[model samples]
Target: MPKIDVLAPRSAYDIECETLIIGAGACGMVAALSAHQQGEQVLVVEADAVPSGSTALSAGLIPAAGTSIQRAAGINDSAELFARDIQAKAQGENDQALVDQIATDAAEVIDWLAQAHGLPFSVVSNFDYPGHSRRRMHGLPTRSGAELIDALRARCEALEIDIICERRAFALFHEAGEVTGVAVSTPDNTQETIKCARLILACNGFGGNRELVGQHMPEIKYGLWFGHDGNKGEAILWADKIGAQVTHLGAYQGHGNVAHPHGILITWAVITEGGFQVNKDGRRFWNEAQGYSEAARAVLSQPDGEAFAIFDERIAGIARQFEDFKKAEAVGAIKSSNTLEDLAEQLGLPAQALRETHADLPLGETDGFGRTFGDVPLSAPYVGVRVTGALFHTQGGLKTDTSGRVLKTSGQAFRTLFAGGGAACGVSGSNDSGYLSGNGLLSAMVLGRNAGKA
Candidate 1:
């Protein structure tokens, strides 16, 4: 067993440790494990109970680009190739050296997740969401995010790391340009201050915090469906108090599928069949027959980045051919109507345009006798689910070098502030998310492990 010393502050106890990590998300958890394994005294303080935040809500996909595991599985991919596809998506905005380093180290990250956290992941082919030429993603079991988090939690518990839950980090302590500790408030209006030598801010996004979202990603400011209930942007506020810089505040990730009011989430396959995507006026915007990824891009590019996936009963059933889409509807995204007029009235789209465009699509494909709508086959009973822009998952945060050390604007190192996962800027330069299984998770794990070592 690794010698673990969980330096916890009980009832406002002053604490000291070699490494102190905030948030218990996948990145924080991985960083804790790596640091502890390296003989560093580690303490982790979480704002919520088990599995709270984006790591709990992730698809559990980790794209370790190239590694021994991938080699053992005979998936012949290279670090250079992975970097190329990511650069293409970014249109050359990302740092070339950083991108290459992450690509080369991706596979090792996957192996660590499995070997260290006991994540039972498998290689997924059809991993191409919108980009990437190779099958370079890893995913958990059907339960997805839960499985990965469970493994991480189990490891944390075994290590005896202090995982203080139900405590909110109200402020960070700093001294002379260095982060020192955090001030936390419990449910009962009691304040607790914990101190440490090295502090890591892994606290997640401000998506659930409406004010922060409004200030940062103003376009679809209110349309985020953070699967985790407590995605308050404490990290941004904390970083600000400590003189940390937050970059890419304007860019927020949006998904093509999510439910309404309750804001349940869904997958993009809903529009793959003959369902026509309609803009505000209910006119056809993009070919619904295209792959789910292309559809996401097309929808986001629409007027104000809004559209509804119009499909009938037939299209819904066809989309259900894939089990994930069906399960996604359980979380929201699937809408229905007994007749076309009801759907049109509900979504406030032009009824005639919808009728004219989808009138030719049959509910079932007998022998694939269609033009393959957008180069991908079409199927359906016309269905149109209204989808608005969503902060799908953050693609960037604090700027960091490939090693996960927070970097200065001058391409130098920022003192002690290391970030990984969506909390850190993605190695990918552009706004588009690659068809990556584990890109975000991999970034967090590999870089976080590196941060732990540092």
Candidate 2:
């Protein structure tokens, strides 16, 4: 329930700006910076007391190809290869034009952040994400989303950009098909209307809205919601009122291995680095190599809708690079033992079944689930963490052109409206299975930059 206030000609406003952006996450922040770089006075309004959104909850990793970092690391990748990876993972269900646009613009965005904003970004060359054919994942030194947001916020501060926090935008005012201003309310119910020549919506999607999630993504409706609470689909609602085109409302990014009860994310690196998941009965159910988004459904279908991620010390060392994994270890969510039997006893799983499952791991050959294990088997000192599925964020919303202009139902662009991040339809196709790692931030930063530059 968001409403659009139709305005007459020559309406006055208490405040004004050349470019106004809603939501202070990666998308909005980047848009603000890009607009400012273009000599446009910009203002950003955030719903929460701070700028933390779904971006802060993530690993802060962005996948980009053909960057200077990639070249320095001697890795060969191109925008075309990245687009093919996205298409192959989504099974060709996504818009090829949109995919190509993001893929092509991603490297430039990454380079811009580093060169202009002084963000210390480097490519992650250790291991490859599920769908990526190259090691193009990039992150800061800490590999933390909070760090990324902090860096962007610092840059905004240095540039003297104005970001107003604790202002929740409730209504959009427009004349005909062109947006004129937005109405925001404070926590104390004080309301103000700010006029702008152009408006960008980066408030993210509806994963946090229970009603909308149940309506569109009922399959993961009952699962855990791990996204920002302020993501209530207000952007999508406003788009609907304005007749802006929306598509793939059911598409979302989900995770199969969130530490249960601890509410901490166990990095998917453990799984990709030779770890396996088992139900309470200690049995492998599906092909875990199919990507973490699809694993949400596979894990939810298990007994009690819960499972345990089993890995060895070597894998744990690799996962230590992630801040979430360290937090998970701090809270005792991760359990380690010198033997599988001891680890099974600690996790309350059947010892015999756990041993048999471990013994059955194929070496140099694909298993029944089509995952091939390496020649090196998991040695002693086993580690495990109790996990459950979670819906991270919705991938579908208002459809926009490559320049990030919101499009009408008749395929015409709105005069002064643009959208990015979760507010716009992503390249994940129509389901969770199509979500490649880092696709969320990929869309957020790329589209946000494009929208501002346009």
Candidate 3:
């Protein structure tokens, strides 16, 4: 079984640095690059050979207002509007300070990445994601997270920052309650102590830990986890050991339509563009417009943990803009048929119920599930994929201030300790319901930058 690397050290080799970062995912990579740009000596360590985490698994949709791209696209958005959307979606349960800080710093960060680091980000105005009133999302041309990660890795390489992989960080070295460094174990089981003036935890959350998931977020115990196994809640564990206050342990991001067996995500753009979901009985169960993450529970509650995503050719063409959806089509993950009955037969569903659902969709008639029909009507060449719910990543961990300073229960900051990405409490509220689109990457990038700067 694949498991997170957690080891006990019996020996130590002394190494020193000005800043030490753990986990080379988007957060750690960005933090290292930002700190290095600021003329600070930095080092990064990763448990995996390469940095493949939730960031790489994501669709790379980053929501930020007031960006140069957004302004060029003629969008009238600002940090206050973004912060309002976040608080409203989170039901006012998240840390407003952190939310405001990220919103305010979002444009600067994106601009810096584009100008200073040569990252290509453009405004996405064609479609809207959940909880956002504007088209402020920006990403690469292909909108691929792998591309985003590759870009960050390239910048890190150019900066000549050393990223030691396959090394597990198990313990923190502290001096009188202030973290000074970390204890890392090599592939050969050799242990070393790397002392530093500052330490940032970007290792991410505990989604891979079955016990931790069961203890904190039991509702998702049966869902599929489609994130990196290296995220073992090392930051949470380490922080808790030192009296750091943790929050939103029940919060997580989930997806309602991950193509089964193919292991590729079916983009929610299909649903927003007039696609629909049905349970095993071939009947619409809920409004798919609720967004993928929020609608995950409905799909998870279906019998045998199975559901089918149904869309027409028009929506398929629109969704093909996403690389994963196109790949799903190429691998025979998406099944297509010329008629509703044929599609239902292929899905092993009742032909009559499926036909009736498609027929009534364009008539503006309300079904038992109350799904409002859009202008696009289902016709010949129906497209679909067998899908299941997935637990993407935990959105909660160590609670920190707006500046990424990890705090204690008494609200005191750890002088030399900071955290970002999955290692820190995300902007999502106390459960899975508060995850707005791009919350994970937003928290990761903004908080990572703050930690590096501070």
Count of backbone collisions in candidate 3: 0
Candidate 3 deviation (Cα RMSD): 2.5
Give the per-residue lDDT digits (tens) of candidate 3, residues 1-454: 1233323322444888998999899899989988998899999998888887788998887889999888888999999999999998899998788889999998888998999989989987777787898888888888888889889999999889989898888887665677767788788888777878888999999999888999999988888998888778887777656778999999999899999878899988888777889888888888776568867788889998889999989888878878899899899999899988888888888999888777767545555666566665877799888899999999999999988999987789998889999999999899888898898999999998889898
Determine the backbone clash count of candidate 2: 0
Ranking of models by TM-score: 2, 3, 1
| Model 2: per-residue Cα lDDT over 1-454, one tens digit each | 2343444434678899999999999999999999999999999999999899999999999999999888988999999999999999889998899999999999999999999889999987776689999999999988889999999999999999999999989888878788888888888888888999999999999999999999999999988899999899988888777889999999999999999989899988888888899999999999999999988888999988899999999989988888899999999999999999999998989999999999999987899999977787888789999999999999999999998999998899998999999999999999999999999999999999999989
Q: Which of candidates 2 and 3 is the stronger one according to TM-score?
A: 2
The candidate, 2 or 3, that scores higher on lDDT is 2
TM-score of each: 0.78, 0.98, 0.95
Candidate 1 vs candidate 3: which has greater TM-score? Answer: 3
Report the number of clashing residue pairs per model: 20, 0, 0
Tell me the deviation in Å of residue 137 in model 2. Answer: 0.6
Question: What TM-score number comes out for model 3?
Answer: 0.95
Q: In candidate 3, which residue pairs get closer than 3 Å at backbone N, Cα or C atoms, i.e. clash?
A: none
What C-alpha lDDT, on a 0 to 100 scale, does residue 178 get in candidate 2? Answer: 84
Note the Cα lDDT for every prediction shown. Answer: 0.63, 0.92, 0.86
> How much is the lDDT of residue 303 in candidate 1?
78
Worst 10 residues of 3 by lDDT: 1-10
